[model samples]
Target: MHADQRKKLINELTALIKGGNAHVTLSEALSGIPADMRTTIPDNLPYSIWQLLEHIRIAQKDIVDFSISKDYKTLVWPDDYWPQPTDSVTDEQWADSIEEIERDQQRFFALLSDEGKDLFSPLAWGTGQNIVREAMLIADHNSYHIAEIIVARRLLGIWK
Candidate 1:
């Protein structure tokens, strides 16, 4: 791709992954959720808002770490990717989780913004996976969970 085209692609991906798109961004979805509702498990739902938030944070961290790490090992699915669901999550824990998510997201954005990097080139340490693929994965995964949080909020009557 041309240099200008590459730059446009990066900008678009950044917006979609972070915020300012049609889908609800993580920041928007998490906004105004009361502390009590974070751990409240609505009927028929397998996970609470807190669990979902922590899971997203954990998965995003793993993906970003895998992209940059020279020696990356796949995490054990389901168990490793999700936090233990409980009603004991405190406000501090929620804040910490959000901070972790934002920090890793910034790191991922830096990776996307680096002009020296090739989005299409496969990581030498990994099997055929490229930065672009990982970015899309992060965006898709985050969007899905953010929507889940929104749904949970709506069901709980916390979101208007």
Candidate 2:
């Protein structure tokens, strides 16, 4: 791709990863939620805000690790990706989870910005998965779950 095109791609990907261009950011969505509200699963919802938060963090970390780690080990499906609804977190743990999500996003953004790495080329360790595909996956996956978090908050009467 041309230099301008490459820069634009990276810029768009960064925005997608950071969110708020077309939807609420993770930070904005989670902000002001009372500590007690974090674990309150609404009547019909499958997970609490805490579960969604940890799930997003875990899944994003897995994607980032798989993208760049040479020694990536597979995490179990559903079980590893989604936290137990009964699992509660300390205030510190909640903050750490959000921090880790943002930090991993920046790490993935760095990978996207590295022109030296071909985004279209599948990593030798991955089966036909490339950085471009992984970028799209993370953007789609995060936005989907983040919206769920927003919906969960609305259901819990915590969001405006």
Candidate 3:
């Protein structure tokens, strides 16, 4: 791809991943949720807001770390990707999860923004995966969960 086209793609991917585009950002989705409601499992929902937030935070960190790590190992499915579902996440824990999401998101964006990086080149240690693919995956995955969180908030009548 041309340099300009590549840069444009990077910026668009970053915006989508960071919730800077049309869909609700994770920060916005989490904004009005009271502490008491963070762990409350709305009826018929498989996971609470806290569970979803923690899962998103964990998965995003994993993907970002994997993209840069030469010694990446596969994470255990479901268990390693998700926190224990409970109605007891502490305020500090909730805050920490949010902070981690923001921090790791910046890391993902930094990787994409590095002009020296080849978005199409496969990682030296990986088979067919490339930075561009990983970036798109992160954006798509986060967008899906952000929508889920928004739905949960709306169901609970906490979205504002």
Candidate 4:
């Protein structure tokens, strides 16, 4: 693709990944959640706010690592992606999760911003996977969970 087209594509992908265009941003959705409520699992929901936050951070980190690492190893489903309900997070840990999520997103953004990288070209190490597909996956996955976090907060009567 031409430079103009590539730059536009990068901009759009960055917006999508940064979120808040169509739905609440992950950070916004996560903000102002009561500290005590982070561990509370609303009725019928399988995860707490803390679990959702950690899960998003972990998955994003994995995707970013996979995108950049030639030796990326596949993560175990449900196991590697989701945090255990039994697990508890401290206030510091919660903040750390959010920080890592943001860091990982910036990492992916840098990759997308790199003109040397071929957005459409499949990685030689993977089976027909390209940056565009991975980027969409990141945005799509994060948005879905962000919505889930909002729903959890709403269900808990914590959303304002």
lDDT of 3 by residue, 19-130 (tens): 7577878888888788889888778888889989988998988999989888888889989998887858788888999999889988888888888888899988888899
Candidate 4: segments with Cα more than 4 A from true spot:
none
Which residue segments of model 2 deviate by more than 4 Å? none
lDDT string for model 2 (60-159, tens) is 9999999997799999998999988774578999999999998999899999988898888899999999998899899899999999999998887888
**Clashes in candidate 1: how many?**
0
Residue 26, model 1: lDDT of: 82
Sort by TM-score, best first: 4, 2, 1, 3
lDDT for each residue of candidate 1 in 4-44, tens digit (9 for 90 to 100): 99989998888878964877778888889888788888888
RMSD of 2: 1.2
TM-score of 4: 0.96
lDDT of 3: 0.86
Residue-wise C-alpha lDDT for candidate 4, range 47-99, written one tens digit per residue: 99888888889888888998998989889998988887754568898888898
Indicate the residue-level lDDT of 21 in model 2: 86
Model 1 superposed RMSD (Cα): 1.2
- Name the best candidate (by TM-score): 4
> Which residue pairs clash in candidate 4?
none
- Give me the displacement of residue 115 in model 1, in angstroms: 2.4
Score each candidate by Cα lDDT.
0.88, 0.90, 0.86, 0.90
